[model samples]
Target: MLQACLNGGRMRDFHPALPFTATEIASDAALAVAAGARELHIHPRGPDGAETLEPEHIAETLQAVRSAVPGIPVGLSTHWRIPPGGLSRQEPIRRWTTLPDYVSINLIEEDAEDMIALVLGKGIGVEAGLWSVSDAQRFVGLKDAAKCLRVLIEINEQDIDEGLRAAAGIQAVLRQAGSTLPILMHGDEASVWPIYSEAMARGFDSRIGLEDGNLLPSGRMAGDNAELIRAALALAPR
Candidate 1:
């Protein structure tokens, strides 16, 4: 599946077209879906334009985007840095009146297992984010790894060759651990398109959006999330 990561933890200064509010995110989501995005990934923002895990902000973001693109699975980031960890990070999720279809939680975080269990207990699916071989090993060690919706093989490495090597190492760990979970591979900035193409070539799911990059594979600046999705689809026909 090609997931659209509409707006990550980026501020408006990062990109003039980056969506910040519920309405803006919803509109961008609809456009992305129209351009062939099957899933949605977003980072909800508070009134101050900062990423927030507050229940009200999350509910509003989910409602607006889901309304705009009904039937497409929508996911959110549960990165620990949002509230800087501890009970404060988990409390807001517990209090969320509206839940997303799933969420991505990095396995490298301190309370990752607890967060996964908490969200699962609430009946929300999980997308385990594995950034390195160690993170992948950690994910496989979790008793609930099989219950996750999928595993995100995130390559933060900027060098294309190194990024692919990192992805391979992470996959090796999962394979050794006998994990049969789905994989969604992605990279950021300079390596985004390369990793995405590799994911397609490997027959794994991939994603694209302003969060990962603002340029097309040809190095031209993309107009919006929809344009990015279109370029991603053109990489390989499904």
Candidate 2:
């Protein structure tokens, strides 16, 4: 399914167009869904535009977005920057029952396994994020690889060519793993469209949004999440 990453780890200082408040995220979620996104991925932010895992903020954000686009699967970011690690952040994962349909976990983080276990225990899907080929290989080595809810292969790069190579390397690792777990591939910045096209060609689902790029494939500043979604749909394989 096509998922829209409304906001990521970045602050508004980096991209003023980023949706920080619940109202803005909800509005963008509605627009993205209308434009063909079947799922949503959001990173809730506090008033100062920093990421947060506070139950109240998460609850309000999920409620607002889900209310606008009913039944659409909404995922939350379990990024280390928000809650860091250890017993303290455990409450956020436990409190997830109050909000979110799924939560994303970075394979490179120290507490990735614990977080994954927590999410699975709670009956919530885990969107395992692999930023590099090594991360993918590490994930493949895990005993519960197939048990994951979903895997998102995020190619991090500023240049399109390099991103394509990175994605290719990740696919090779997955092939070596000898498993057919559901995979979603996408890239950030200048690599977004190139890797997205590669995803379509490689027969994998992909994602697009302001978190991936503040501008459209044409390099023009996107007016909203829907605009980015429309641009991505146009590039999907026919």
Candidate 3:
């Protein structure tokens, strides 16, 4: 499956066309689906244009995007610092009035296991985000690890060789742990296309969008999320 990560915590400075408000995000959702994205992932932004977990902001964003792409699974990031306050990390999640189809939780974060159980109790699917081999090892020990919708192997290493090695190491850990959950791999900045290509070659699900990078595999700046999706699809093995 090819998921479209709409506008991760990116600001307008990162890409002028990056969506922020509910309306813009909804519009992008439509275009991205049309471009062949099977799933959607986003980071809802508040009025201040920062990633937020405020109930009102989450509701508004989810409503708009789901309306735009009915039946398509839409997920969002559940960063531990989204609300950034003295409140417990799970407080914002508890206060959420509207929830996404699933949420991506980084395994390296504090309270990761507790957060997974909380969201699972709420009937929300979990996308375990493993950024490194250690994170993957940590995930293998979680009580509800097998219940996750998928494992998102996110590579941040800048060098192509290092990034691929990082991905392989994580996969090795998961394999040894006997985890059969589906896997989705992606990368950030300079590692984006290379890791995405490798993910496709390995027949694993992958994603791309403004959140990952503005440039296509050809090194040209993408016009929008749709363009990025198209470029990614073109690389899939036929």
Candidate 1, residues 30-134, lDDT tens digits: the string is: 999999999999999999888999999999999999899999999999897786455579989999879999999998888999999999999999999999999
Compare candidates 1 and 3 on lDDT and give the better one. 1
The most accurate candidate by lDDT is: 1
Q: Which stretches of candidate 1 lie over 4 Å from their true place?
A: 84-87
The list of candidate 3 runs beyond 4 A from truth reads 85-87
* lDDT (Cα, tens digit) per residue for candidate 2, span 1-238: 6889988876666567778899999988988999999999999887776788877888888889988999999998887767644546767668754667888888988778777888788887888899888889888887767888778999888877778888878888988878687889988888888888888887888899888888887888888788899998988877
Q: TM-scores of the models, in the given order?
A: 0.98, 0.93, 0.97
Candidate 2 vs candidate 3: the TM-score winner is 3
Ten contiguous residues with the weakest lDDT in model 3? 80-89
Off by over 4 Å in 2: 84-88
Candidate 1's displacement at residue 145, Å, is 0.9
Each model's total of backbone clashes: 0, 0, 0
lDDT of each: 0.93, 0.84, 0.92
> 1 or 2: which has the higher TM-score?
1
